[model samples]
Target: DLDDPARVLRSNPETYFKSPEEMYRLFPGREEAVERTLEIAEKCALILQDTGVHLPGFPIPELYRNADEYLERLVMEGLRERIPGAGEDVFTRAHYELDVIKRMKFSGYFLVVWDIVHAAKERGIPVGPGRGSAAGSLVCYALGITSINPMENGLLFERLLNPERVSMPDIDVDFCDERRQEVIEYVIDKYGKDNVCQIITFGRMAARAVVRDVGRVLKIPYGDVDKLAKMIPGPGVTLSKALSTVPELKERYEQDPNVRKLIDLSLSLEGLARHASTHAAGIVITPTRLLDHVPLYRTNKGEVTTQYEMKILEEIGILKIDILGLKTLSHVDKTLRLVAEHEGIDIAMEEIPLDDPKTFELLQKGQTIAVFQLESAGMRDLLKKIAPTTFGDVTAVNALYRPGPLGSDMVSDFIERKHGRKRISYEHPKLEPILRETYGVILYQEQVMQIANDLAGFTLGQADILRRAMGKKKAAVMEKQRERFIEGAVGNGIPKKKARTIFDLMAFFSGYGFNKSHSAAYAMVSMQTAYLKAHHPQAFMAAALTSDMSDTNRLVVLIDECRSLGIVLHAPDINSGGVEFGLSNGEITYGLAAIKNVGVQAVRSIVERREEGGPFKSLFDLCDRIDLRLVNRRVIENLIQSGALDSLPGNRAQKMATLERILTEAQKRQGARDRGQTFLDLLGSAGVSGEIPLEDVPEWDESLRLHKEKESLGFY
Candidate 1:
């Protein structure tokens, strides 16, 4: 109120530039054309002076040329402000690139990436060290935003961002696989719910799913259907190629008339959307409310879902931030808890060793079962072969073993580095430190940016433009850049032919380059989980299995791991087993919630009654205490079959046989309790008199008892 607030924006009347159209609109008069052109050229001069480059080509890049001259001038001035030592021409490309960024007002876009990621680190969340071309950013590296320093690594910023091609900077953050979601929730909270959402992705009907579904719908015999399906490789095999790959399926297709029809239908539907799922981590947060920009819906589970998939959302100008859940963070958290309680060191997880010899030994030996993402059999083989000796090796394996990198010539280069079969080379003297770790191969997007800047007369800012174009793979933009790069190299006195060859190499690596920042982040998690599996095997496995109690194979593998570690496990005892798999006195108490045919309501009734009274004294006592309506004889028989009722002295079969007598006694006892006839009911059996009297059946043999327990308990 004290100030003329409106004048702050309106009082810029001291001869600033405006376009002819803009001037006509702002102060429309035919007489003002000469004055407006004068103002515009002066503004353009000021912009060019900031870049210190004589504007030679009529068009440099889109950001370089004519605009509302004042807008162009303001953007150029903003570029000067961003990069302090702006050169006349070389840094002019950078200044021009900065102008593109300024025109787009993407300073805040980069800032948002830093803010959310640093917030996660402040909360002790393990974000990746650096990933992709975002690592090529000196601003990012300086801010600890990206771990790989572009200067040291020779990563090119142009490979990350090119004014030649205007696009959003994509920085993917990696947290421990286990803890990725906590950061996602924080984003939803920071940006309002309406402005933040995870993207949706469709699952295409692949080979195995197609066969199983089609077989079911056709009502084909399951044995024949499954046999045909099994003959086709279930994982990664496509329906188009399955018949070609499997002889048995081919035989069925050629010989069986009905089978051919089923196959035909399955192939038609094979690549259709079988289901919808959230993108693993692609979340777009917007400055304005997102729903105003894109529609929203609730998934079946009631989570807020985005209408746009990853590519479509970006096309509409929404930013996608990947909030990946790293299971390693959860593992590390669980390990730390176990250590604090049991080991008494109270070791904070972050304080644990990154260079522990034992941990590396465990990884080198391929003993990384239940160790984050590296638990896969293939990665385990790589770990053993590489025999990683340091954190660098861990990160290298994380980056290099991925599908793209593994498929390329780089895998051989990486293998040579491990074995010293090929000597590491930086090509030019300056690239030594940049490529030293991965044996002179630029393994990341940052390395691409640094290369353009250091060797090819590109400023860090211009190099970012190059990075963007390469990542986008805009053919025309890359072609122009390729010429520009060769010109710069030849002008710098390098041979054009060699520059072309190097350019070719850069293009190849750019295609499959991973982000070092993200790889480091995930590698840290992989290390943490490996550390836990190495140290506190029992507690870690207990928590891991508890998270996946519904999965039978997971339960069995975890149990086996527990046994290998010398941790004892009790059978699923009805009296002691609670709803969750938990550690009790260094032994795992099996979760009764995992038993077949025994529903949660029944488990809840049994558990609540046991907690209220002492433990169940016998079958009769258990049936008497809980509601039998929920806990039917089938449920009771399941409990007995699972050895959950073994807390009582009699064999499982005996316990099962007595279920009839027990239910009869239980109904009478319930009546006595309901009618307040407890004292007389026990002494004279009056309450029990009216109940349908049932007798106990004969007990089963021990082998049969154990076998029955295995069936219900999933002990196999």
Candidate 2:
């Protein structure tokens, strides 16, 4: 009977909890096993209550006796490096998670996260310091998994993981978006490529999409289908909700057989998986070749993917790593390279000082553009009034500049407090240090954790547990924690009612506390770019424009940034423009590669040929010296239309007329040279053909020329 019950628990592996009676029936009178089953169920219940409010998490499997003691041993065992003091002895919420992890046998998961993130750092890929509840972990900061000291930030580890609330840590790492692929490749190389693969996501038939698909398949009138699809409410509500609002649809379902079929089928099919695509940032690594544990499929690009979803992989103990590309890192790298070439400066972009007053002054002016994650117009407006003066301000503003805070009077309060116009009140004197930097407000998860430990005589690990109860919004657990906290505070000579009030306040905001580690990590990038914009506007803007060359709208915004900085941006110039934007004589040089129809390789070829045999004197000289096979007549026409060939043109129409003749002659000359013919000697003996007017085509008007240029080069 006990065996049957145990089998049932195993069958329901997806759910996190089981009943004591169920466990007893499965153990068949084995007292020790039966006892363990109750222990497991109790642990699962404590964590599941956490999920109902906010944390939807699965419990870690049990390994040894005594959760905290087991965690200590796991900590000792899972040190990836054997250096002295590479131990998890720190106080904070992170510590609590580590302790719980050891007892729960989830130390391997932390080690796996550490290893991948370490590799990223080694490669100088900017991994995010921490995100979500992970920032509350002191262990993460100690492990260098995060850079912001949670001890200083006052983060609660229990918010990340708790003895009572056992769940896998949802840790996301950020790398420079451009360099993110390099880290993924490294993982593939370390773990067997077959054993590592990104997670697969399914695209569902959303309300409008389902209706459209049904309409197409049913051969309904196209206009009718489009109108009906548009009539479906969007932004949040789905087709099912749309049908209720549009009584006409209801009437059609009742009155028309085909419309009824359409509506009914669409309702059933909405949200069903329509196609499978690999997760953009999620990847899982297995101990052995992935195929040994899970079935795999190949993407269109021939990349392997596990048949198991992200959760399924975790259930089986496969490690999941999110290798997110930050795109901003790519911009940084490109900017550095441009600076090296154009300014002859070996400016170590990563080594830029974090505390630059001038940079903050510019930020205070609300002059941010082409800055990672901080260029929104609304954000600019916030910065103008806030007048942030320190690295802390950047972090605070970044965290507070989101939706809820924007809607509330939070922005004005934060600004006034930071500038000293408003008094910073901690509500209690002992909590002053923790609240001082953030203007007497608990804006980070770490702060809540630190406050719990400081005032309540709780250990850092226990504080983390309290943090979780608060963050989860579990009313029962929160109520219990509140009573215990008040009792502790009263024991420590604080009023019981005041303690209760503060605990309630922590509960209100802990759910909203931004991770200081993540905010600081991102703020570092935003500031570095800001610094560059402050001092090296031309080079920074050139790189920003180059990175966004393919996107006219973004390029347009960056062009505006360049103008505000008083840096001139020249249009594409065949003679002076390099492959991408670069600074020259205090101005942003146009990128020939950005010119539409001009591929990088083709432009590169032209540049290499020019470098090898000196610059061209004219159209004839260009045709004679360069291989025009790659930059054929059409490419030439585009170049002229974009005014890239303005150095040789009467106007676009004249150059367009003569482009075919130039390419044909270049091809003939190349063919002769391949056939062992001496074109230079023949031309010299016959005397160079000159003085003849070569197709004096009419010149295009300025607007016509610009339009053609825009069409060819993808400019607007």
Query: Best candidate, lDDT-wise?
Result: 2
Q: What is the lDDT of residue 351 in candidate 2?
A: 64
Which portions of model 2 show Cα errors greater than 4 Å?
1-166, 169-171, 207-270, 342-344, 420-423, 456-474, 680-693, 713-716
> What shift in Å separates residue 489 of candidate 2 from its native position after superposition?
3.8
lDDT of prediction 1: 0.70
Model 1 scores a TM of 0.66
Question: What TM-score, over all chains together, does every model reach?
Answer: 0.66, 0.77
lDDT of 1 by residue, 57-136 (tens): 11123653443343345435544554456556534443554555566656555556666777888988766556565665
List ranges where model 1 is wrong by over 4 Å.
1-291, 296-307, 319-328, 460-479, 490-498, 597-612, 626-635, 667-707
Across 239-319, the per-residue lDDT of candidate 2 in tens digits comes to 778878888767767788877777788898998999989988998866667665668888898877887777876665566
